[model samples]
Structure formats: C-alpha cells, structure tokens
Target: MEWWGVLEGLLLVLVLAALPLVLFALRRRWLARSGSLVECSLRISTRSSRSGTPGAGWALGVARYSGDELQWFRVFSLAFRPRLRVTRRGTTVLQTRPPEAAEVPMLYRDQRIVVLADSEGRQIDLAMETSSITGLLSWLEAAPPETRYPV
Candidate 1:
C-alpha cells in the first residue's frame, strides 16, 4: 500500500472512533440547553463484604425538573428518557454537603451534593450548585397540597 493509503486508513479509523464521542457530546449539549439540565453526580453506594463499609460510586448525569418530577439522564447515554425520576409529592431532602475530598474530584466544579429520601425509603444523591439546590427545594415545596396527601 502507498503512504497516502496508509494515512487515509488511519484517518478513517480515527474518525470512526471519534464519531460516537462527538455525537454524545452534541446530544448532551442539546439536552442541557433545551432541557435546562443541571450537572450532577448520582451516587451508587455499595457494601463491602469484609468490613461491610459502604462505598460510594458517583456517576455524572444531568437533571431537569419536568412538571412535578425531577428527571435524571446519564451524561453518556443515548436514551431519550431519564434513567431515574423523583417526584415532588413524597420526596424529602435528608441532607446537603460539599463534596468530600475524594468526591470533589468526581463531581463537577462548584457543585453541592444533596441526599434525598423518597417515601419508599430509597435514597438518592444529587449534586448541583447551591442555587440549583434552592430551586429544587422550592420546586419540591411548591407541590400541590392534594398531591402531598394523595387519596
């Protein structure tokens, strides 16, 4: 094969590899601008066998408030629907804290992580800015009175 052919082959390989990444980024940007996505970390806590210590794994995702629900979509996923949804009716904010030294590196810049529990006792960790947290709290608090005590 000629030198130009080899270069062309390499170029094609690079483009094929990078195409998915470019598409993913474009999709995320579109979601952010159009859907008002808030960058966040979703914690996946695990239990260790030996010591039984809880370990946390954070996945970067974007969240948006849709009507009375908060929808979370993974940053790298191609799905159109959110992977997790939290409704305003029976959700409670358990705590809020700055990212730990270990978690800071995993979280986005200037994001605060908040722990929330649903009525079913399931815990979800959401990371966002202080302003976003305030907005979330407001949204949760603004749920209709009837929804708070469903018939």
Candidate 2:
C-alpha cells in the first residue's frame, strides 16, 4: 500500500475513535442547558445490602428534576435519556452524613452523602452539593398538602 493509503487509514481510525467522545460531549452540553440539573454521584442498589455503608461504585451523573420526578443521566454516556427516574411521592431520606475516609477520595470535595428510599423500597444513595441536597429536599416536600413525603 502507498504511504498516502496508510495515512488515510490512520485518519479514518482516529475519527472513528473520536466520534463517540464528541457525541458524548454534545449530549452532556445539551443536558446542561436543558435546565434544573445538578451534578451528582449516584449509587443504586437493586437489592438491600446487609452492611450500612454507601456502595463503593458511585456513578457520576447529572440529575434533572422533572415534575414530581428526578431523572439521572450518566455523564460519560451518549444516551440523552435518564438512566434512573426517581419519583418524589413517598420518597424519604434514610440517612445523611459526611463521606467516610474511603468514600472521601472517590467523591468530589465538600459533597455530602444522602441515602434515600422510594416507596418501592429501593435505596438510592446520592452524593451532591449542600445546596443541591437542599433543593431536592424542598422539591420532595413541596407535594400537595394531602400528599406526605417524609424528607
């Protein structure tokens, strides 16, 4: 093959490798500008864990609050849709505390961990900024007078 052919092949490979990254960036930007989003780390448990510590694997994501629901989208993903949708009705905060020594290194600086459980009994652990947590709690508590959501 000629040198020009090899160069062209390399360029094609490079573009193919970068296309996904470019798409991910574009999706992230769109989600950011969409509004009412907070950058948060989430740890979702399919089943209950015996030990009472946040899962070591926390997925970094942005959460957008829709009417009575919070949608979580993974940061490194190209999917524009939310990976997890949490309803505000009957959601309760289980625990709130500072990150443990091991968790501190994995989490962003000055972030607090809040464990919450939905009506379905699924536990969601989220690490977020103080203001974001306050906003979330406010939203949870903002339900109609007849609806009761324990914060």
Candidate 3:
C-alpha cells in the first residue's frame, strides 16, 4: 500500500511536468495547421540600410495562413492600428501573424518571430524579409509539385 502511494505521487509529478510540454506541442501543431503553404520563393527588397550594415537592412514577410479563422484573427489584430512589419531572420514572432497595435500591450517597432523545433535549445527571432508576392507566385508557378509541399 505504501509503495502504491509513492508510485501515485511520482505519477502526479510526472504528469504535472508533462502538461506544459504537451500544451506547447499542441499549440505548435495548431499553428502549423493554421499556417499557409509556402508555394515559392519571393524576391525580397528591404529598405536599404547603410552599406556594411550587419543586420537585415530591408525585407518583407508573408504571413502563412491556412484557414479563415486565423485569417480573421489577423485582420482583427491589425485593427488596433499598429503597423507591424516582419522581423528579420533569427527573430521570433509570438504568433505567425501580426497583432493589432491597440491589442498589443506594448509596441515595439521591430517584431519577434518564434521558431518551433525539437532540440535542446529553442529559438525566437525577429521576422526577416521572406519574399515578395510576385516573386513567390512566380516561383510557385515555376516549381515542380514535389518541391512545393512542406516536409
């Protein structure tokens, strides 16, 4: 009976520790499901920073949206009147799409884009210029089907 109690306690602790991880994984899965398919590459032209600038000078981002629900959320968030551009590479976005300026508790001109992975360390970076709609569409139209699907 004592052993049973000990096992039960251990199980409880294990479950408690795992709950957050499970929730996190589920959230990521939900986001991925909501993300749009990356069909092709876009030519990204960003504001030209001074020559020899180390960081991403100019770039735009394409928010990936897979469904209407998320799409509405995107529009709703933007209503707050904050102009959010994509963060540069190595940056992290809390959510895939930009939020409303009014909705955001605090506003930072530069945004962070989150990266999900399975590794010891995690990464969050400012969103960088991804590609342009015209360029992406062109690439998508040209690329073979095998290359377009996400892995």
Candidate 4:
C-alpha cells in the first residue's frame, strides 16, 4: 500500500478507539451528575423540617423499594451498620401489618430522610429534615466498632 494510504488507515483506527473512550467518559459523567442530584434532593428534604430540641436532630435515612414485594434499607448513620427489611404488603403499613421479616426497628424520629426507589435504580421520592450534623457525628463516633467500616 502507498505510504499515505497506510497513514490514513492508522489515523482512522486511532479515531475509532478514541470515540469509544469519549462516549464512555460522557456516560460516566452523566451517571455521576444524576447521583449528585439524587443526593441533593435528599439533603433538601431534611433541611426544611423542624429540627426539634435546639438543633439536636440528626439526619438518618431509610429506603423502601416497590414492586411485587416490599423491601427496605435503613441507614441511621453513615458510619454505622445498615438494616435491611423485606415485606409483602409494604413499609407504610408497618403498624397495621408488621413486616414478614423484621431486622431492626427504624425509628420515625431518627429517620430524618426517607426515599423510595424502584428496582431499576430510579428514585421515586425523598424526604429530609434538618439534622444536627454534629449530633450525627457524635453518634457515629460512639457507634459499635463492628458497625464501622475501615478505610
């Protein structure tokens, strides 16, 4: 093949390889942005609630899943253990119809934030209340060693 033609082919191959890398980076950026928005929504929900006890409130989260059956994940503190719950009816009627499998009691007061999502990873809704960021830190510090994850 002519020198110019060979160079042209090499250029084309390089462009094809770079194209995929560019597309992958764009997808990652998009997913990251969406995750950030979800996190922001959770933070805002708690920001407006009545942070009772002179800012003694803390932000804890509970996530409920929808579809054929009810499922949930509760995280009281980022540094502590996570509780998972699964039910047939749903979490909303926990009092009327208790969960089929009980893990840990999720306190309404501690749950400053609640989120609902589908299996596809789409967030359905979220709720948040002003949390004493300081209190959460203290609770996390005192949390059991087994509950914490080492960096």
TM-score of every model versus the real structure: 0.78, 0.88, 0.32, 0.26
Residue range 1-151, candidate 3, lDDT tens digits: 8899999999999999998777656644554575542221112223342234323332332344322111111211213221232212222222333423432333234443322211222332223223423332343334354343222
Count of clashing pairs, candidate 3: 23
Give per-residue CA lDDT, model 4, range 1-151, as digits (tens): 5999999999999999898677656654544443321121121113345333422322234433233232222332322222332232221210111111221132233323333332333332223233532332233344355443222
Model 4 bad stretches (over 4 Å)? 37-151
How well does model 3 score by local distance difference test?
A: 0.34
Write one digit per residue (lDDT tens) for candidate 1, span 24-74. 987887777766888777873322322222234678888998887899999
Q: How would you order the candidates by lDDT, starting with the best? A: 2, 1, 3, 4
The candidate with the higher TM-score, 2 or 4, is: 2
The lDDT leader among the candidates is: 2
> Residue by residue across 55-145, what tens digits does model 2's lDDT show?
4878888899888789999887888889999987778898888888878876777999989988888888899999999998888888777
In model 2, the runs with Cα more than 4 Å from the true position are: 50-55
lDDT, candidate 2, equals 0.84
lDDT of 2 at 126: 91
RMSD of 2: 2.0
For all predictions, the C-alpha RMSD in Å is 4.0, 2.0, 15.8, 17.6
The better candidate by lDDT, 1 or 3, is 1
> Candidate 1, clashing residue pairs?
none
lDDT for 145 in candidate 4 is 52
Cα displacement (angstroms), candidate 1, residue 81, comes to: 2.7
